[model samples]
Target chain A: MHYPNGKKNDQTQKTLANVSKSHAFSNRGMTLEEDINAANAFYRDTGKASIHKKPTPIQVVNVHYPKRSAAVITEGYFKQPSTTDYNGIYHGRHIDFEAKETKNKTRFPLANIHEHQIRHMKSIINHGGICFLIIRFSAHGETFYMPAETLFRYWDDQINGGKKSIRYETIANEGHIVPFHYQARVHYLAIIDKLYF
Target chain B: MHYPNGKKNDQTQKTLANVSKSHAFSNRGMTLEEDINAANAFYRDTGKASIHKKPTPIQVVNVHYPKRSAAVITEGYFKQPSTTDYNGIYHGRHIDFEAKETKNKTRFPLANIHEHQIRHMKSIINHGGICFLIIRFSAHGETFYMPAETLFRYWDDQINGGKKSIRYETIANEGHIVPFHYQARVHYLAIIDKLYF
Candidate 1:
């Protein structure tokens, strides 16, 4: 099967295998999403934060119901999300962010983010909520928490005919490296504490 | 066609007509969802607030892509949401809420809300985010904004073998009535301002 993006199922399987082989997934090779979910779960359990990954929005077209089972949606299409993936309350402040992973070793491409996502981030920042992006460089086995403000600068630079991608060195300097913990796998909130608080 | 809930599409149409006839829908008989969407749009346009109703979550089981056009989800199921419907940043505070409507005249049934939703509201409150419910009594032409704290009391009462429904009188006494506005539509934020700010 091929996705709308033209990526075949086998391609996705190969990518997953590559991720497991290249990245430091030591504990049964967990995906980036799994790590974040684990971290969020830890946060929720410990009263540290209350963040949740919003479910992928799908526009359902047709549904079929069996007499004795749950209703099944037979036709639908994936909808482009209007906002960031994760958002919630943190220290009485609205926390909004998007997380993305790239396998590139030298740079992170800005094209990985959608235009509407950038607009959404801007809106959050304007509303006085803390907004940021969590970027994972799988090739280097590193993750960084980059504030929305820094991201905006890069975004504007691109619009003004600058580099299309952010260099690894730039991210290293401007973004806070998120440490991976056993329990709190992606410890991005620790960076938020130091940066925002 | 009849939905799994046994409500025919025509019955829904009749209910909508009844809603327009009995309740306040000054603008060409808009539904409660439409009113809230309008309010949110106005809030966004005017920089008054940043709130959005999360899309209904659907779990896709199968998909098919034609030679051209968008990919179609062939099989799916409506997933129960883990959190409230509407959530965003208001005055730098995390704002979370669920909006519901009932055609019943005397009482609001507790069954209108899921148990997980009650738990989710509690978590939001514990995390210091402002949470509430926007309920529309279609039979009475009334709408009210009830705080999560007030909702928790009733929810807990039901769990303790108390009343399964909250009397309309209780809602009128404890909740703030949401006034209708020309541009702002539902104007629930006005109540939020008085209660929280």
Candidate 2:
């Protein structure tokens, strides 16, 4: 960020307001999650897709129910998610995918993705659900939709002592680029339309 | 019933531990959630389907990341889920549902089903996803599968000066019973198979 994380952000926001909304959005430095959430909201509002992000899995060990207020989780631990973070029905097909952002422009390290998650994605694909990954290269501001099949290849190669990451060039050539827009920051359904519909 | 307080609690915990290890679907007193989870586990293990219960939505306010342990959610509140609790794919179709158990023998109350959840179900059905509710009458020990389409009729009726609950007899007559099995305790997919496949 050009300025400190404070009133400077709002000050710059106003200056950027004079520019295009999309241009402002990129300069504002919204995370990939924020962009995808905005895209999901747009898709939902337009009746294009019924996609949603599944809640972070938390194992609640204890809860305190106050007299009139909501129940408060006193002791809880985040659990490893067995499935991808997002899924829904799109065009009568079961759509499932996990999204991640990497600052490294050279490659995406596979350490963040767990083995059980890979198994879950494989199961989804085996059951005829559409599964993929949305990888955003933060340094390059490029997001690519890599199918689970393609990811499995790299994952298996990694398991067998291959390179630990998927090269950015390989993804750029093999994966579909998710377009960005003012309303849908990551208009990924456009890529899905071309690939599936 | 005759045991003392502390001993009874320990015995109960031990019984639960044993029940979990042994696939004892014949065992009594399993909650609707446990039954549904067992059914989902069976489905996943057998490669029959890939359904899963979505994690309870929690709004985490504060977290404590200790030096050696995993992050602990120190302050969090339960969130009202906009969508149903469980959803996945079966037979190449998206399956979405909310499951509940009622001890009341006369009827199932409408207070628990939120308006937004009903709207989400409608959208899921509109998008060609298989949507439904799994209602279990704990007193009667009978579980029924009620389609979202049918549930909407009752929901709309209740919205417009109708009864606040669905009569148990009405459900027994119109809804499909979800058979209990040794492995898949709920065995709800059986009803889906008969209805769709």
How many clashes in each candidate? 1, 0
Candidate 1, superposed: residue stretches over 4 Å from native: A1-28, B1-28
Off by over 4 Å in 2: A1-28, B1-27
Per-residue lDDT over B57-174 for candidate 2, one digit per residue giving the tens place of the 0 to 100 score: 8766557777765777776667788799999999899999999888788899988799999999999998999999999887788999999999999999999999899999999988
Candidate 1 residue pairs that clash = A73-B76
lDDT tens string, model 1, A132-183?
9998887778889999999999999999999899999999999999998889
lDDT of 1: 0.84
How good is the docking of model 1, as DockQ?
0.39
After best superposition, candidate 2 residue B102: deviation in angstroms?
A: 0.5
**Per-residue C-alpha lDDT of model 1 across residues B1-197, encoded as one tens digit per residue:** 11323433455566556646776443346668888999999999898898998888765555677765567777666777888999999888899999988888899999999998998889899889999999888777788999999999999999999999999999999999999988877999999899889
As a TM-score, model 2 comes out at: 0.87
For model 1 the TM-score comes to 0.86
- Residue-wise C-alpha lDDT for candidate 2, range A22-79, written one tens digit per residue: 4323334787777888999888888888999999888665677777556777766687
Q: Say which candidate scores most in lDDT.
A: 2
